[model samples]
Target: MSRERRKHVVYITKNSEYHCRDRECVAVRDRRSGEWLREHSALRGRLIGAVTAQGRLLRRMRIVVGMRLCLEGAGDEQLVMTSVVRNVGRPKKSATCAYAYQSWAGVIGA
Candidate 1:
């Protein structure tokens, strides 16, 4: 059976880390409901964000980060849906294309 997709309020920080906490600024507040982008705001240009995912897709994504997600279990667990990212960190020096692709694929069967 295909898992139903769920939208998550993900914030991909400059460190390429995932943080679901309220920025305590306009990025979180000001919105009536649901996560979205604000122009010329705290969420602008930091990184691509606010994605939706399914359970299996979420699990596979968690595997990619070696499950090194910085979230509190139980409480924050339900808040976030899923994610997949490389820790190349900052992108000043890009991970080699081969390595980057391999890194992502390496987590698939784990």
Candidate 2:
């Protein structure tokens, strides 16, 4: 029998960890069998939008590490930011910031 995929609502905590209502966040393990079930995946540069409580799209937004989001379909086919009324906290610096600085340094032969 094939198992069906279910949608999930997740949020990033202040420490930059993914939390879910279903207790299926990344790096979670089953108490019975100590097997790794999930791992981090690349989601950079993906287009996401804020959603209202009534499932309405508010506006397009970027996926930050501290935002609450809902995955609507399998393989993250649709990612919608949820709970716009709650405070998501400030986003951290982009990972590319260091890379951009290094690139500029190389160009200047510094």
Q: Estimate each model's TM-score.
A: 0.19, 0.29
lDDT of 1: 0.28
State the displacement of the C-alpha of residue 34, model 1, in Å, after optimal TM-score superposition: 19
lDDT of 2 by residue, 13-69 (tens): 332333332322222222245332233331221324444445555344533433345
- Cα lDDT tens digits, model 1, 32-102, are 33223222123212222223333222222322333333232232233332233333222112222322343
- Best lDDT among the predictions, by candidate number: 2
lDDT of each: 0.28, 0.34
TM-score of 2: 0.29
Stretches of candidate 2 exceeding 4 Å from the true structure:
1-38, 45-47, 61-86, 91-110
